[model samples]
Structure formats: structure tokens, C-alpha cells
Target: MGKEFSSVPMYTESAEVTKSFDDDGRIKRTGTLLTASSHIITAVIGSGVLSLAWAIAQLGWVVGPAVLMAFSFITYYTSTLLADSYRCPGPVQGTRNYTYMDVVRSHLGGVKVQLCRLAQYGNLVGVTIGYTITASISMEAIKKSNCYHKHGHDAHCSEPAYPFMIIFAAIQIVLCQIPNFHELSWLSIVAAIMSFAYSSIGFGLSVAKVAGGGNNVRTTLTGTTVGVDLSGSDKVWRTFQAIGNIAFAYAYSTVLIEIQDTLKSKPSENKVMKKASFIGVTTTTIFYMLCGCVGYAAFGNDAPGNFLTGFGFYEPFWLIDFANIGIAVHLIGAYQVFAQPIFAFVEKSCQKRWPESKFINAEYMPFMGSHGFNMFRLVWRTIYVVVTAVLAMIFPFFNDILGLIGAASFYPLTVYFPIEMHIAQQKIPKYSFNWMWLKILSWSCLVVSLVAAAGSIQGLAVDVKTYKPFK
Candidate 1:
């Protein structure tokens, strides 16, 4: 299992020599390990963490953390493979791949590159929708909690998720205007802090509840214990859903190369990325463990998909408001971080397709420099954000959207492609134990991802029929 790590070189000399310059002839790359790790953490720890209790309900206490840790390790390993895969043979020396699609184009050719783009775009868009849903739900929770505190049992909070979804979309529209990936580092830092803050609050609240007596728990249990004894096909499907949740929570590999491309030292960017990924994943995993375990213990089998909303009229209403605010803030940053690559791809694609278009050059516009807003940025991004917001308003099932994205995209992006690219880059023989094992791992991951995707799609279909748009 660890053989893959030893197979790929830490850094290629060609990557160190490659240089990218802006029109002004200044150094365009900028990132330290801390900023890089912050972005990775922001990308990895989004609204997905709020659903860890639902995943725990599927897998139980004994198996939940173990599976979560395993997925974390797998994601880290694949991310490193992806980081190393950026080095390819240039016309003179070797070229460094900057984007996810670039790596596929370099290794698998143009056909696979399109497929990779589809998956990458779909995953990012899915994540954006999930963020909107989560943010809207968080705002709704705060409103409900406040109303309950004021009016006791008769309080009724009538505000729906639709308006909040629109508000979240509007916030993202502004944040997404930040042009450079490296420039968003400060925003990522703030998002990371918010993630830690809310996670800590949830963990502390769950622990305090479990310590007091567990009488407020709403679910019937085997004896008052936390774990559920899952059996039959229901268990099977929930286990698959749990895998998707864990995978989605850790699925930040698509942007690894793009993030690495921002590092000042190209030669050591691979090592820097590996270090950042480890730190980010480890930190998120600890938070996940604390939140998931205590949340399940506090709620039992009846835990809601979104844990923050599941709290429902609890004491210390101010803390709930604070945590929900953190979630809303964090998602605003997370949306921009994930959506930047998609925006860049679209802009580049449009320029390529229409070379004579006035939007190609940022030279004439008043507020536009080389990295400033262009016509596509004003038109396409606005449309993209609005469309995504409408999707969120229509289908507001947070966990199901996550599961669908993870099942559809994670295996290919996180597991299969990285492993395949590693074997291809290293030219490892098919008969070799390392290659064989990686193939088996990739296939197993693919089968599981497919099952999770199927379950998510089925669940989503049912939700479509039963759930109202603005309710």
C-alpha cells in the first residue's frame, strides 16, 4: 500500500526550471506552506463536515472513525501523486501541468482531458450547490433558534431557505471576483478559522449533552448507548452513503495542482503540497472525529443530515447563532476557492474559441488590468452563479447533493486517476506487485463510488418528487 509513495520522485528538476510570467514582467506565483495549507483546509472542510453525524449513524462509532481516517489517508496519498504528476516532458526540457485538466491532457491525451474537465466541473458545481444549501440552512437555523428563545414553544420561524440561498449566491458573486488563486489566501485563512470555530462549538455542545444525561436525545436506542446495529440492505446502502460523505469531505484533489502552481518555488512545490495536504487533512480529521462521535452520541440514530440544524431549539442560543454565522461565512469563501478554477477554464476556453472577440484583451477597460475582470467574467460568471443558486433553491437536500458529487466524481478524481497516472508516469509494469495492488485499490474504490452515486441519485429522485421548491 505504501509502495506508491516510494515509486514517484519528490521533485522533478524540470518543474523547478519552468517559469510563468504576467504581462507586467513581475513574478506571478505566491504561496507559503501556511497559505497553501489554509486553502487546502478551506477546500476540504466545507459544509460537508456538518453531516458527519449522519455518516456516523450509517457506520456507527466503532467503524465510523476508522473509515473516515482511512479515506483521509487515501485522499492524502492520491493528492501527493497528483502533485508529482505535474511534471511532464517539455519541448526543451519538461513542462509543468498547472490545472487538473492539464495533467490529464499531458498523460491521457485530449479525449480524456475533456472527460476530466466534465468531472471536475460537475464536482465543483455540485459542491457550490451544497454550500448554498448548507449556508441557507444555517441561516434558517439561526432564525429558528432565535425565535424559539424569544417566544418559547409557540414560536414559528417562517423564513425559508430560498431567500438565504439567493443571499449566499450574491455573496459568492462578489468573492468570486477575486482573480488570482494566491490572492484568495487570506480569505481561505479566515474560512479555515471559521471551520475550526464552528466544529469546536459543535463538539463542545455534543460532549456537554452526552455528559449531562443524554435524556434530550430524540431517538430510541438498543439501551441508551450511542451506536446503532445496522443490518440488511438498509445498512448496505447507508454504508455506501457514508463512504460518499467521507469521500466528499476529503475530495480536494482536483485543485491540488492548481494550488501548487501558485507556490514561489516551483522545484519544491511538490514537497510543499505534500506537507500542506498532510497538515490540512490531519487537522480536518481530528475535527471530524470530535464532531461526528459526539454528535451521534448526542442525537443517536435520529441524527439529521445537517447537524447544525438538527440541534433544534437547544439552550445557549447565542452559540448556535455564532456557529451558524461561522458556517455562512465559511461557505462564502469556500465557494470562491472552488469556483475559481471553473471560471478560469471557461474564460480560457471562450478566448480560444473566439480569438477576435473584444473580450479577449483586458487592455482597454478602465478597471481591467491583465488579471482584472473581462467580458466573460462579467457575463458568464454571473450566469453561472445565478444558475447554481437556482439549483440550490430547487433541490435543497445538502447530504444528498454531497453524496451524488462524491459518488460521481471522487473515485475518478481522488483515487483512480491519480493512481493510474502514477503507474503510467513511473512506467510500472502490470505484473509488479505495486501496480497490481494499486489497480485493485482503484477498482474497489470505483465500485464503491458507483454504488454511492447510484444510491444518491435514487434518493435525490425521490426528494425531487416529495420535496417542495421553497419550503
Candidate 2:
């Protein structure tokens, strides 16, 4: 997360260094296909997936899974487009763009690059906020003694999200200091494992609940009452917000380049990335399907905003603790992975804007460099973590925030930009059938994502009117 592959001087003197598939010798390109897939899975599946039950709960059985799968397909296609879009038109490996904003600047010009920067930062910050909320909530669940039973029985608990959010932010203040995504490879793997563990445990709890004659399974489109009239504005709005939630759960496009950069150029980087996307999305989709379906079947309309929080069983309370702990752990890694790009962009900008600044060092800082202790790194990352923590404290609504982030960014980052960049880079004809279809597809995505974004705003407005901070 700290290193900049772009700044690595391309070694044209050595053919191997400039090997189309190799890193300009600056990056070792040590990752294999499996590692690449793991990173993709780690990037894609996060605490957000825990909310899928509630998300699909709004769309019902039919539409919910359909939308989830649709997003999986959409993201996979766009992410590959992004990977393929990384290289420039010529055979010169030196001309490649290594970051998302660089891709935009190369293909679409400065205006779009600026816009891309906005969306990328917005999405990254939004991810920090969302992960902060999840980690805090998970820790809170662990702290509440017998809180699992209380959660299931509608009893009150003393554990609040604020203190734990502060605690998690403290941890992020440490981890965010790591500079690059490649450096967090071990953490990413652990995050992926934790993601799977929580997912399996969640699904098991749901199955156990249903098997124990727990008649609480009550499905509903509005998420509260069964068969609510679709004509009502409130119900329709809720459904769209659900769409946002699903999209948010599936969003990993923002970090696609960072993930792809981890892989070696051998065996084709785009091919490896495509395989990684397929593996990650397929695995996540299966887990999501099981967890979402089983969790809904267990709690029906009564499922918690977080699917894991819904299961308050006393028989195996340790499982809840383990699952929640996994969530907290995974999110710590996730926060770093998503935060790296923004950190790099800002630091590079600082270097350019103040070339003569005392903090600007001419010597290259390798991954895990001693210079990581510098004032600039410490200050900016601390500020980033603190600001995100504050936001989480003020608005701790898990599902709603996901909707807002997804709505605001899903179209621009995940859908619109990738396809647009592909069309531009490939120079697809303006009036050709391929161009027409892609135009239709991209515009449709724009419209859908905008609608979802609106729904998120509406939900947030309502939350502002009624939400109790620290409650």
C-alpha cells in the first residue's frame, strides 16, 4: 500500500527488466495465481457480506439472489476490463499506468482523472467508515455478556458501537501506516480465511435456528412486514436501498488495480487477474447465497442489520465471539488494503507540490522501509483514521452507510469508468454495434447506480431525523 510501482524507473537496459510481463525490476512480482486469487477474495469479501441477508431480505428470495449474481457478473466483467485497460497502446511497458487514477489520466484525460480521483477517494474513505462500523459492532458483540440471547429475545444491551469504534480506530492508526497492498499479503490471506470462517459459522447458526423449531422465519419485501404493498413510496424506496446494499457488498472494483499489481507479469497479468476475479466472485457468491438464504430462513424479517448479529444462541456463545473476532480482524486488514491507494496518491501529490520540502527524501523508501516513521506518514494516516472513526461514531448505521457508499461510487468506479476506459483504449468505433451496446450497458449502469445512490441519501436523511448517536 505504501510503494508506487509507477515511479520505479523502467530498466530498458535489461530486456528481462522490461519484460512485458515483469515489473520494471522495482517490484519483484512474487505473487502466484493462487495468491492473486486470495487477494481478490480478500478484497471482495468483507464484513459487508454479513449484511447481504438484510439486503436480499428487501428484494425477497427471487430478486435478492438475482441482483447479487448480477453484480458479481457486472464486477467481474468491469474488473477485467480495468486489468486489460492498464497497459498503453504501444509495446512499451514503461508507458503503463499502475493506478486507477493513472488509468483515467492516460485514457480519458485530466477531467475524468480528477473525477476518478474523487470517486476513488470517496470509495476508499467510505470503505474505511464501513469497516470501522463493522469492527466496532463485532467487538461490541463480544464484550456484551449474554448479549447473544438478548439480541435474539429483543432485550437491551449496554455495549455500544462508539467505544469499540474508537478502539478499532486506534488499531487502524497503527496498521494504516503500512504503505502498500503487497505488504499486507499475509494479512489479506488471514482476512480471506476469517471471511470464510464467519460465513460458514453464520450459515451454520441459521441452519441450527431453523432446525430447532424456531418459528421466527418471516420473510418480507419491506424487511419488516411480509407482502407489503409495492405501491407505497416507503416500500419502493426501501427496495432500492436494498439494491445499494447488495451492490456495496459486491464492490471490489475500486481495488482491482492494486490487487492486479501484486501478481507477476508471467502467464499474462490480465489472465491471472481474470482467473482471480472468477475464483473470488464465485467463492463469495456461494458463501453469500448460503449465508443470505440460511440467515433469512432463520430470522426472516427479523434478521439484524448485520446477519451475524442476528444469532444470539447461548448453546455455543464462543462461536459468536470467534465469528465477531474474525470480523474485527478481517476488517483491520481490509482498512489497510483499501486505504493504501489514497495514501499513495496523497503522498505523491505532497512530493510534487513541495519538492523542496524537508520531508521530501530523494532516496527511495523500499517496502517496510525505516523511513516509515516519518512525520508526514504518521500525521496524515492518523488524521485519516481519526476522521473515519468520527464519522463512524456519528453515523453507525451499518446497512445504510453501505448503501450510501455503494450508491455514490458503484456506477462511476465499478461500472462506468472501466467500460468507458476500455472503449476509449480500444478505440471502439462510435457508431459500431459493439460501441452502441457498450454505450447502452454503461448508461444503464449509470442510471441504476444513480437511483441506488438516491435511495441511500433518502435513507440517511431519515436516519438523521431519528438516529440516536452512540445508541
Clashing pairs in 1: 90-94
Enumerate clash totals for all models, in the order shown: 1, 7
lDDT (Cα, tens digit) per residue for candidate 2, span 357-419: 645433344566453345577788899899999989998878888988888888999888998
Predictions in order: lDDT? 0.78, 0.78
Would you give me the overall lDDT of model 1?
A: 0.78
Top candidate by TM-score: 2
**Model 1 stretches with alpha carbons more than 4 Å out:** 1-26, 89-93, 216-233, 363-371
Worst ten in a row by lDDT for model 2? 3-12
Clashes of 2: 7
lDDT of 1 by residue, 154-219 (tens): 656666888888888887777776665767888999999999999888888888878889455644
